[model samples]
Target: MHCRPCEPRHPDAQRGVALVVALLVFGLSAALLVAMQSEFTLFYQRGSNLFLAEQGHAYLRGAEELATLALVMDHDADQSREQPRDDLGEFWAQQATPYPLDEGGWLVGSLQDLQGRFNLNLLAATVTGTGEDGTDSARFTPAQAFFIRLLQALPELQLDSREAIALTQAIGDWLDPDTITRPFGAEDDFYSGQSPPYRAANRPMASASELRAVANVTPELYRALAPLVTVWPQTPAPLNIHTAALPLLRSINGDGELVPLSEMEAEALFQRQRSEGGFASLDALLEAPAFADKNMEGVRSLLGESSSWFLLTAEVEVADRNMRLYSVLHRDERTVRAVARASGSL
Candidate 1:
C-alpha cells in the first residue's frame, strides 16, 4: 500500500517562481551598483574641487609675494600712486601674468590704486564748516562736491540740488562722531522718526555699498556712487592721484568755478592720461586748456603720487571653473601687510 502519487507540480508555476526570484536579485544588485557609482563620482568631484581651490589659493599667495618683493626692492616705490613704473620703476600694466601651475590654467592679477576711490573715513574730517548759527555746516569739499555733481548727472537718480546737498551733508554726518545738528546731518534722533528708528553710522563705512544707510541716500544714488567710493581698513583720506578718475580730476580742478565734465569727456581724459603714461605732475594736468585755470594745488594735495595701501583683484581659471580673490595690502614702514582676503567661485 504505497502512498498515492502527489499531484504533479505545474512546470509554468515553478519557472515563474524562479523567474521572480532571479529578477529580484538582479534588481537589488543593479541598485547597489548604481548607488556605489554615484557616491564614487561625488567623492571624485569633491577631491577635484579641493585641488583646484588649493591651486587658486597658491596663486594668490604668489601674487602677494611678488607684490611684497617689489615693495621691498624699491626704497622709493610709492604704492599710493598707480604709476606706470613698478618697484624698480619698470612698467607693469598688463593683465594675466603667466604662473607655474601645472594644471593648465591661468592666473589673472591686477593691482588697483586704492587711492583712486574716496576714503569714506575722510568724509567726516573734510566736511568742517560752521553754519551761520554756529552749527556744523555740510559744505562739500572739492572731492565731495565732485561726487555730488556726478550723482546729479546719473539719469537714474531723481535728486535736485537741495536734496543732493542734503544727501552729502547726511553722509558727512553719518561718518562724524558728535550728534551736533547740521542742516543735512542725521543722528539717532533724526532716524528715530522713521518707521524702523535706526541710528546713524557714526563711523567710517565698512563697505562703499553701505552708503544707502545715510539719510536722503537712495539705492539709485548708492549705485551711481558705488564705483567711485571705497572703504578700507585704514583711515579714509584723499584719493590717489595716479588712480583718481577723470571726473575726480575735473572736479578737483574746477573747484566750484566750473561745471563738471560729461561722462564722455571724463572718460576721454582718463584714457588720455593712461595712454600718455600717468600724469607726470599735477602741472601737466593743469596745462590742459580745460584745466588751465582750475585749482591744481588743491588737486595735488588731495591726490598724492604714492600710496600706502592697495587692493589686489585676482582671477584664476582652471579647466571650466573660475575663482576670484580680493585682497587688501598695506605697506607699513618696510613690510607688506595683507589686511584681508576674500574669495569666490564661478
Candidate 2:
C-alpha cells in the first residue's frame, strides 16, 4: 500500500497522559488511607466506651452491696436501743456526702426510709359495709382522710378544694377493686375518655410516682405529695415523727378538728421532740401537747418503733455516661434483703 509511515505521537501529550494516570492512582490511595484511619478511630472509641460502661456497671453493683451491708449493721444497732426506733438520728438517715472513686468519677448514694411517708395503699385496709347498690362498696379510712388533709394543706400543691377531693377520690378508687367511684373520684370510664386513654388500676399502687395518673393530680401536687406519701408494703408504716413533715403530722391530727394545732404548735412540738432522740413511743408523742385530745388509737396503729423498708438511690457517672440505680431494701433483725431493683442509663 502506498503509503506514508504514521507520524509519532506528540511527546508532551505522552507525558501528559502519564502524569494524569499517576495523579488518579495517588488520589485513590489517599482517599483509601483516610477512610481506613477513620474506621480505626471509630472502633477505638467504641471499644473505650464499652469498657467504661462495663466498669461503671460493676461499680454500681458494688455500691448496692455496700448499702445492704450498712442497713444490716444499722438494724442490729437499732435493736440495741431502749426504744428500738429508726429516725433521722440514725446513721442510715444521715445525709449522704459524695465519696470519690479510685478509678474516676464520684459515687454518691443515699438511703431514705420509705416508712417516713404515708402509705396510700392503706386505703384498702378498711372493711366495707353494704352500699346503696348492695355491692361491696369501699369505706373511707383514716389514711384516706389524712391524704385529703395533706392535699388541702399544701398551698404549693396548687390544688383547689375540688381538685384535692377529686384526686384523693381517684386514688382511692384506683386502690379499691370495685368499680364504684366516690362522688369526686374517677373510674375507668373517666380514664377511657382521655386522649391517650388508659384504664384505672384497681389494685395497690406499685410506686409513689403513680399518683401522677390520678385525676386532678397535677404535676405540682404530685411533687409536693411524693415526698410525704408512698404506696409500699400495703400496710401503713409508722411515720418517724422526727423526719415526717410537719404538714403530714398536722394532717393526721385533722386540721378542722375541735382543737387543731397551729403551725407554730406543730413546729414547736417537732423541735422539742427531736431535740435529742425521736419520740420513744406513741404515748410520748401523744404527750407532745399538740395532739392532746386527738384520737390516737388509730394513729397509734400507724406508728412504728423502727423502719423496716428503705429506698436506696445510687448515681454513677463514667466517661461522660451516667447510670442510675434504685433499690428497695427491707431490713429486719434477722437479715437484710433487696426487695426490688431497677436500673437505667441516663
Candidate 3:
C-alpha cells in the first residue's frame, strides 16, 4: 500500500504519556513508604510494652525479696526478747514507706499476720465419738464452738444459733471425705441440683475464697467474712491472742460460760493489751480480770503467743505500668519463704 510520509507525533502527547507513568510510579512508592512506616511503628510499640512488662515483674520480685529479708530480721529480733510475740506493734506489721526505684517509679509493700485470723481448715477436723449404741455421735469441738461464737459476735453477719450451727455443719460437710449430710448441712446431693451442678470439695480448702461455694455464704457474707479467716499454713495453728481482733478474742470460751465481753469491755481489754505491750503468755491473759469467772477449759488450746504465717502485698509502679503482687509467706526461727504468690488484684 502507498502511504504518505508519517508526521512527527505531538510533543504534548508524548510528554503526557511520560508524565502518567511517572505519576503511577510516584504513587506506588509513596504507598510502600507509608506501609513500611506503620510496620516500624507497631514493632516499636510492641517492644516497648514487652520491656516495661519485664521491668515491672523484676521490680515485683525485688519487692518480694525485700519483704522476706525484713521478716527474717524481725524474727531474729523477737528471738532475743524474753517474750517473743507477733502483734500490730511489731516491725513487720507496720505500714511500709514507698521505696524509690532506679527507673523513676516507686515500690511499696506491707505484711499482715495470717494467724491473726481464724483458720477455716480447723473445721475440717472430725469431732466424732462412739455412743452407747456403737454409732458415731458428732458434736461441736471447742474450735467449732469458738467459730460459732465469732459468727454470732459479728453483728453484721446476724447469724443466730440455728443458722450458725447449720452453716458450720455445712462447711464441715464440704471438707469431710463423706457423702453423709449433717442434720443441718448440705452434701453432693444438695449441690448437684444447682443451676450449674457441682460437688463438695471433700477436702481442705486451698483458699478462703472457696467459702463462696458453701451453703448460706452469700457474696455479702463472704466479703464480711474473708478478712476474718484464712486457709493457710497447710497445718492449722492456734490463733495469736496478741494479734487477733477483739471479736475473735471475745469468742474465746468453753461451754456453759457466761456471755462474752461486750463491745465496751472488749475495747478496754484491747487498750490494756496494747498499753502493756501485749500479753506475755496465755496464762497472763487468763489472769486478767476479764476471765475471772469465765470458763476457759477449751480456750487455752485455741490461743497462741506467736505467729508463723503472714501475707505480703507488694506494689510496683514503673513509668505508666503498675503491678501488684500478693504472697503468702511463712517465717520460722531459721528463715522465711514464700509459699504462694499471685499477680494483679487478688
lDDT of each: 0.66, 0.73, 0.81
True-vs-predicted CA distance for residue 244, candidate 3, Å: 1.1
Give each model a TM-score.
Answer: 0.72, 0.85, 0.88
Stretch of 10 with least lDDT, candidate 2: 130-139
Pairs of colliding residues, candidate 1: 79-307, 80-306, 80-307, 115-240
Per-residue error at 345 for model 2, in Å?
5.2
lDDT (Cα, tens digit) per residue for candidate 1, span 121-205: 6556555554344422235565556555555555566455567667767887888787875676677888889888888878777
Q: Write one digit per residue (lDDT tens) for candidate 3, span 4-78.
A: 999999999999999999999999999999999999999999999888878888888888888788888888888
Task: Arrange candidates, best TM-score first.
Answer: 3, 2, 1
Q: Judging by TM-score against the true structure, name the best candidate.
A: 3
Model 1 clash tally, residue pairs = 4
CA deviation > 4 Å runs, candidate 1: 1-19, 73-102, 126-161, 177-181, 185-199, 216-220, 253-301
User: Top model by lDDT, which number?
Assistant: 3
Model 2 misplacement above 4 A:
2-11, 125-127, 130-139, 158-163, 234-236, 254-261, 320-322, 344-346
| Model 2, global lDDT | 0.73
lDDT (tens digit, per residue) of candidate 2 on 189-209: 999999899988988999888
Q: In candidate 3, how many Å is residue 4 off?
A: 6.8
lDDT of 3: 0.81
Instruction: For candidate 3, give the lDDT of residue 157.
Output: 72
